[model samples]
Target: MRFTRLAGLSGIGFVLLLLGGNLALVSAGFPTPSDAVGFDEVARLHADASDALRLTSALLPTAWLLATIFAAGVFAALWRHDRIRGDGWALVGLAGILMQCVAFAGVGAARLAVATTATHDPGTASHDLGAVAGLWGLHNALFGFNQIFLATALLGLSVSGRRAGLVGRWHAAVGLLGAALLFLAATTSPYGADGVNPLALFGLVGWLLWLVWIVGYSVVLIRGVEEEVPSALATP
Candidate 1:
């Protein structure tokens, strides 16, 4: 199969892996960043769910790899259009996707550390609440900031793809809307770190939109259909 086709498949794989990881996390009763519980509670939860946490951690690397490939495929598809030649929006989108991979690596590491620390010695982990809390904070911070990269990817690709006539106007609109919400969430993330807050809602809604947009985008890529560019826009 062509690399392009493989990349399209990888996009769906990425989504599936992400969904599986979330399911594992939910099944394990993992706390969200917005959970207002004390560090001791956090440690206990981690200790109880160590296996599930580890499993989630294991899924992340493969998901990030697939996400990177999908971004490259998007860039390849968009960069060929004359409208985006000098703007390099597709390249920016690719960079956003790559940066997310790097940022999420930190998230996975923090989660794994919590799982390891909590499971090894529950008493000791309780005693070292500060360390565990720090790790959890790190995880939350990374998770919050990662939305910025997602927003960047959405903005770059949506604008360029729309200009290139590679995606429908509604698709581009969804991307733009998602970008705005995610960016808002990133900006307000600090306020939401400790517990449930209004700021978290922005991220939640944006993430849902992101899932939708990515699935739609992936289907479009798999179809490999490029609408005709207008004569005026097609001119070099």
Candidate 2:
């Protein structure tokens, strides 16, 4: 039997495990955007929010780095082995993860900058969160695109063995669809203060599915994987 991917799978597990840390950062002292237009009122909240974001900033980088390294393991397993099917999926997933790193850092910093710029004057309330809003919208917009890559990657993996080429097509198609919606959210319509957007939630769910699939499939693949004749790799 051909060897599956043990090390790569384990790497994915480790990568996903970092999400717990990220969650903790987000929860530390998150701030709520308020409708109030008073600088003084917003300053308190903004400072509180900034403190939380600082923690989050630290968390996201660590999470992203861990995930990237872990994903590299996946690449080694799927790509090095010329497991064309899984490798394609992994590439797509990697794109999303990388984009997330940018989005998280840019947006987090932007929000923090805005919060810092705030003054205690109530008159400046209207402009107080300018930086915050800029980053908030930009980050969410990127997230919209970023999440789709992950979904496409996962979907690709699920159906890779059956039809590598076909799966690639699906990966591109679904990825495009997810990214498109995100683009729309970022540019045209956008997800404003209109309660939670269902599309955003769906994106998250799709990602979770991919993560779960990867972790589960990884276990099965790892158990069965073994070193084999190098010639076998050249067969198909």
Candidate 3:
């Protein structure tokens, strides 16, 4: 019931999800939007994919859903102590995180569709494959939206945390830096998720750094201020 403990557990789950998802991706050879070339290639890949690949692909959305819950918990825990506009930042960040989760869920659904229906009737398979390809094409935008909002939320949290004396200025700085990187990486056409090739790399780096910040934030949340903070938020 403790907020900090919840956050810590959430953080741990997130890291585990990240590791597991990537491993699954590797095992499944699931083509990311950034890597796949066209519909035919995607169709072929899906047709050849094993059940493990399809099921593993479903993990992405589950992970993101956990992230959304974590974000809400974090915002609730921090809002109380945050007087210097931290509340607003936390709210915004929560929103961003939620939106990102939705986007990721969308991607996951597309992946699952292939995994679930890849072996159906040829006509169904063709339609599903095309859907997957279209989803992949839009992946950039969906993913970019997440990065942008996530960056905003992180920056807000960092600033608010620093102001509350819950975290150091340097900690906040890292978040800001990470957010900046994500913003650039999030640059994509509004109509689609398309963006510069190299930018995705930058975004990936930024996301990793932000995850590091979350680890620290989880620590802080677990070790909240002594008296005013609730036992649930303060205690591990």
Candidate 4:
């Protein structure tokens, strides 16, 4: 009898998590200020702070692992909604995300502390340079790949799952696009030496697309779930 409508309820969580996290990141990201004539005052301070800064910087990807979890969780829910067959796949995806978060938390934290200890402060010239450098590696790229894979799986689930149907398809598509963009984020502009990383903007935009997709789908799915179809025999 507990015919709870998932359309309105849990789906909204998906939207908020994606959107809220993105907004927080954007607002928090002020860029590494570079305007130090001489390292007189800030030099020692920056060097002193390197350890702490490094730890925090390293932990960023770990922080985003939550988003990865959220992404996997969202996709898992989609599996349920779509009535897809791969509950096991969903579980594996979830495990990858959870493990990724837990494993990276401490590791990234240590790195961040170092970065924090290195960079004096954002106001200083060499704000997050070293920290940014640490992120340019295979691990970041691999993690980014995981995000894209999750998105694609969800989109595929949406298309094939009968429960969600057309509405679900659209939802999956948007979410997938968002996840795809996440890959480019690590290598984009700031992370890359090229100065302009398209993936950077695309990643954010893609993630935002996911937020919008979930919100829009929540409304539609709720309505669909609540609707009572009147068959031909019941027509008065």
Clashes of 3: 4
Clashes of each: 0, 1, 4, 32
> Candidate 2 regions off by >4 Å?
1-18, 29-44, 80-90, 118-124, 161-198, 217-224, 227-236
Per-residue lDDT of model 4, residues 101-198, tens digit only? 45445444543443444454433445454444343233234433444544444444334332434244455566556656654563443454333344
Q: Which parts of model 1 are misplaced by more than 4 Å? A: 123-127, 193-197, 226-236
Tens digits of lDDT, candidate 3, 1-236: 67656766786687678778767776676555346355655555666775666567657766776676667667766666637452576667777777777776765665556444544532245677666556555654566666887688787777666655666666787889899988887764343333324566677778888888877777665665444244432232
lDDT of 1 at 154: 91
lDDT, candidate 2, 73-181, per-residue tens: 4444445444464446556655655555566556566556655664343225556455445544554455444444454444443333223221233333444454444
Return whichever of 2 and 3 wins on lDDT: 3
Q: What is candidate 1's TM-score against the reference?
A: 0.91
Q: How accurate is candidate 3 locally (lDDT)?
A: 0.65
TM-score, one value per model: 0.91, 0.59, 0.78, 0.48
Best by lDDT: 1
lDDT of 1 by residue, 41-123 (tens): 77788998888787778788799889988888888878887778998788778888899889989889988887677677643
Best to worst by lDDT, what's the order?
1, 3, 2, 4
Q: Which lDDT value does model 1 have at 12?
A: 89
Give the 10-residue window scoring lowest on summed lDDT in candidate 1.
227-236
The residue pairs found clashing in candidate 1 are none
